[model samples]
Target: MSLIHALQSALGENAVLTQQADRARYEQDWRGLVNNPSLAVILPKTTAQVAEAVKLCAAHGARIVPQGGNTGLVAGAVPILGPDQVILSFSRLRAVRDVDLLSDTITVEAGLTLATVQQEAVKANRFFPVSLAAEGTAEIGGVISTNAGGLQVLSYGNMRAQVLGLEVVLADGTIWHGLSGLRKDNTGYDLKQLFIGSEGTLGLVTAATLRLYPPVATRASALVGIENIEQGLGIFTSIRHAAGNALTLCEFCTQPALSLGAAHTPNGRLPFIAPAYLLLEISALEGARDPREMLETVLMEALEKGRVLDAAIAQSERERLDFLALREAISEGELREGGAVKHDIAVSLSRLPALVRAVEDLVARTYPSLRPNIFGHVGDGNLHVNIRPPAGQTMADIANHKAAITRDVESLAISMQGSFSAEHGIGQLRLLGMAAHKSQTDLALMRAVKQALDPEGRLNPGKTIPES
Candidate 1:
């Protein structure tokens, strides 16, 4: 029979969505960048069902797009390959399979939200360190697929570090049940790494086993106003030196970005306004020194040294979240402020200031009418450099210049030996960038891997690796 009929018959009619309205939510990307309808959207509740759906799709010669929470900044989870592809959504597969407190690992189904995973860790008296603004809705599977980086990446590393093992369904419907919590595994190529950030291009992730940490005891957060990025970098160094591994977050934002956030988010008022700002956090475990005392001392030194213009340290949990609210509200503000030509780029810690300076110079010299909204996890050298229309003008005003602007900005990042796409994976949005920034050798090796893992290019077709 037909693929849709087969899927409906095998996985139940409720699991296979064909009507336009039912598939609408799965079709759109988080940023509203893509909204192409797929031939069908399948919500598989079990790994076996996922494999069954994939096998049927492969038999019918239909391409499959594996999706998680669909909260990715890039359009990685949505279908862009016309109306012939099928979207395999893991939304119904959320299950806390195991929580081994002694082993310090939790095995969960792919559909579990990051926030839910964090809650589970807390319930087990442990901690899951990787956190982003979209944690409330972004699934663990997509987080693993993107190798996502967030605030705590400064200390706990990215999603890649947290993952110990994964359960994935291959393109041909073979389930690789390689879920292991072992910390030491040198038994070959470490196959799970291949699927971690593959963007669902190689295999469809069904579940994962992730590392956990000791629960945080003391916590502190602060927002520092600075004269420029250089001053912020100096402050970051001072705090990192003092707090060491305790420093969990170090975010930078331009004055324009702060203004945008304040305009959009609740409790988004700035404590002190300056040319730029830094939001920092520290979490202490066990017998570690009080984080507030440590951060306060570092901030005092920064103010005294003239590296920071002013600082406001959070006194309570509510106050700390308020401080973070302003930082998290940045993307929302950018969207409301007529959108922007966004770039997720990064450089070395030492080269970050140079990158910022060079970006400012580029915008000022070429697109004088455009305003640059720069902010991100500065501690990790990843910054979102977004170019928006000046004040009153909308994104449409700079529509023609978007291509040239993106080219210039990405070129600068490449010149600095940085990345064109940092934490955000290379979805369809960055396919052109993949071609523009990556070397022939790099592309060839990636293509080779794609060939080996997904020979038919059935998984996430025309994504991640660009066409040569």
Candidate 2:
């Protein structure tokens, strides 16, 4: 039997997609930057089905691209090669296997969406805090595969923290069922960490054990206009001191970011005009005092200290979501400005200000016509520095300037001891960046691991670690 027939036999006809139209969705990425045409697309519902499909692909020596929700910014879920590659999509495995309330953990199949996991936690009166703007569509596998970090990371931590264990389907058809929920597991090597942010190069993730938290009874959110990013950092420090561990979010956006969001997101509105703004949130356990009063107090002091120029607290749940909508709508805003070179990078919290200043100076000096759309979880020093095209510029202009712009921008971030790829992970989009920046020693170690796991280089070929 042919590979497609073999896949169909292993996982019914409905599970295998072969037609171009049927495979189009898997071909393109969320950003439309990477397009990898697949010979076939397989959608397996169960872990066993996934394993069998992988074994078949390994036997055939055909390259496999493991995919989740396909919402990743870096084309991590999209294939790199055409025709010969098989897109292994995890869209059907949406099972919640176990929920241990006493242990504060849940085991779930990888294809389940992140929003569904959060809803499941809410149903059990617990909280799963690994969130993102793409949560509604982003699935557990992609979340674990990329080790995503989002709004509440300042307090709750990233996906890496929320994960207790995982079940991965290795590159060579072996299954590693290391799904232990124990908080203290001192087993040899801690193998799960290897696959957590491996970007599907080492293996395909099919399930995970995730941490949960007590539900928050009280919450608060505010959008504070600031003098600039420098003062935004100062206010962030002040708020962190005042809010302490209660500070769940401290995200910032420059005027360009706010303007972009406002232009694209219908719900987006600027409460005040300043050089920059910060969206903050605080949440507390049941019976705890409302966090609004605390944030308001901090905002008042921030205003008094010349850090915050203006501020408004969300008076209702709708208003709070609206405040978040403004921040979340940033990408939509950037879309209106035409093509952009996006950089999701992170520096030390203290060095973030210097990075931003240097980025501004460099962009103004180099890409004289373009403006930088800067916004992100500043509390964590991770920001999206997207160089959106200037008004009236053509696609050709963006194409002409992309290579040099990306090189210089990434160079600046590396100089600041910052990462070129943060939560987005290094997919095909950043393969060049990885080759350009990742050190030889690091690459060699990574290659050794890849060879050990996927010696044939059939899984996610030409991604994450650069080709040797």
Candidate 3:
């Protein structure tokens, strides 16, 4: 029997889709920037089914592209040219396997949405803090595979830090059940780390055991206007000193970003306008000091020290949600305006100002008519620097400059000791950036690891690691 026939026989007819419309849905990524459709789309409902499919594909020497939610910014989740691959989507395996409130861990299927996990934690009176703009649609499997970091990363680290254990399906159709709830284990190797951010090149993650937190009883938020990036940094330090570990999020936004958001969103007006703006939030358990009082004290100190030009504190839950909407909607608003050259980068906290200055000078010198929209998770030192060309420039002209701009910006990031890919993974887009910044020895070691795991190169080829 043929490979397609074998797969269809193993996983029922409803699970295997071969029609053009069915396969087209899994072809493109979230940005609509890439479209590489596959020969078939396999929707597995259980881990055993996934293993059976993998074994069949291995016997046939076929390539498999594992996917979830299909909300990735990078093109790693889609297929590439010259490969008649099969797309294995985990959307049907949407199940919450287990929840341990006392141990503060939850085991969920990879297909469950991040928002659904958060809601499940809330139902149990616990908290799961891995949040992002795409939480409503991004699945737990994609977040684990990408090791995504969002606004709350300043307090609660990235996805890798929150995961206690994972249950992965190997390339040969064997299950590696490393799903332990232990907080500390002196076991050898800690093999689960290998597949956490491997981008599905190592193995397919079927389920995961994630860490949870105690629910916060009181939450407080504030929107502050600052004069410049320097003042924004100063405000961060002041709030950290006053609130300590209670500070959950500190986000920075530029004047142009706020203006664009106000122009696009129906109710997304900035609370107070200045050269720069920041959104600060605090969360605390019951019987602890009032979070609102802590925010007020911190803001008053910042005001006295000239770190803040103006500020507005939210008094109700609705106001807090409205305040967050302004920060979340800016990117969409910018996209609606025109084409942009975007970068997700990070630097040391002390060197952020100098780094920004150097990049700004370089852009001004090279592209005289470009305006940059600078904003991001300032507390974590990750900034999204987007370049918008002057009005009247044709889209083709702007599109042709991306290669040059990416090269210069990535080189500067290397010089500043920052990373080229901060939250976004190194998909096909950053293969060149990785080659330019990564050393020959490091690249060789990565290739060796990939080969050791997937010898046939049958899993998500032409992504994460460059061709040898």
Candidate 4:
């Protein structure tokens, strides 16, 4: 039987889509930037089925692209064009296998959305802190592949930190089920970690045992107008020290970003006109001192010291969500404008000001026709400094400068001792950036690991690790 027939036999015909129309949505990325059509998309409902599909593909030396929510920004989940690769989508593997409240772990199939997992935890009066704008659609598999870091990374870490155990299907179809809820397994060489940020080059993550925490009993939120991004950083540092782990979030946004949010978001307008703004949040257990009063006191001091220009605190959950809407609406706001050169970069907390300054200098020197939508999780030193041209400037104009602009932006991050791919992984989008910016030694090590795992590059080929 042919590969299609074989896949159809293993997983029903409905699960294996071969026609162009059936594979259309899978081909194009969520951002509409990349569209790499695969020979077929095989949807597996269980780990055993995934293993069988991999075994079938391995026999024919066919490459397989493992995809989850398909909401990735770096195009890693999308298949490489012209490879005749098969897309192994885990959309059907949406099962919560186990939940151990005492161990503070939840074992779930990789296809479960982050929002679903968070809701499950909420039902149990626990919390899962790995969150992002794409939480509604992004699955655990893709999240694990990218090692995604989101707003709560300052308090709880990224996907890499949240994973307690993982079950992965090897390139040769062997299942490595290490789903132990143990907090510490002094075992040699924690193999599960290899697939955490491997972006599916190493293996296909079928499921994961993730860490959970006590649900926050009290919360407070504020949207503060800042004199500048640097002042936003200052405010973040002070709050971090004063509130410690209670400081849940400190998201920074530039004037242009606020303008975009104000213009596009229907309800919330930028309350004050300033160089920058911060959407800050603090949360604590019920027994602890009131988080609202603590946040208010900190903001009062910040205001007195000129670290903050203006502030609007959220006294209710509705008001808190309204404040958060401004931060969450940034991507949509940028999209409403037009094409953009986007970068997610990170640096030391102390040098965030330097990174911002460098970005400003780069824009002044090269992109006079564009506006910078500077925003990100400032608490963790990650910033998404994207450049968007005005309506008058054509996309062709933006395209012409995109390559140079991206290089300049990556160069700035390199000079500041920061990283170019902060939360986003080196999927197809950042492959060139990886080659251009990553050191020879780092590339060699990554290549070696890839070779060791998938020797023929039969899994997610031409991504993550750049060729030598």
- Which candidate's lDDT is highest? 1
- Candidate 3: misplaced stretches above 4 Å? 392-395
Model 2 lowest lDDT segment of ten: 331-340
Q: lDDT (0-100) at residue 464 of candidate 1?
A: 95
lDDT (Cα atoms) of all candidates against the true structure: 0.92, 0.87, 0.86, 0.87
Q: Across residues 1-468, which tens digit of lDDT does each residue of candidate 3 receive?
A: 988789889998888888988788798876666788687899989999999999998898778999988877667798888777889998988899999988999999999999999999999999999888778988899899989898799899989999989999988889999999889998798888898888898899999999999998989999999888888898899888888888989998889877777777676777677988889999888888898998899889878887689999998998888877787777777667775777888898887888778778978999878887888888889988878877766445688788888888877777889987889888667888888888889999989988888888988888899886
What is candidate 2's local distance difference test score? 0.87
How far is 364's C-alpha from truth in model 2 (Å)?
Answer: 1.3
- TM for candidate 3 is 0.97
Residue by residue across 192-287, what tens digits does model 1's lDDT show? 999999999989999999999999988999999999889989899989999998999999999989878888887578887799999999999989
The estimated TM-scores of all candidates read 0.98, 0.98, 0.97, 0.98
Which candidate, 2 or 3, has the higher TM-score?
2
Each prediction's number of clashing residue pairs:
0, 0, 0, 0
Evaluated at residue 72, the lDDT of candidate 3 is: 73
Q: Which pairs, if any, clash in model 4?
A: none
Assess candidate 3 and give its lDDT: 0.86
Q: Relative to the unseen true structure, what is the C-alpha lDDT of residue 347 in candidate 4, on a scale of 0 to 100?
A: 88
Query: Comparing 3 and 4 by TM-score, which wins?
Result: 4
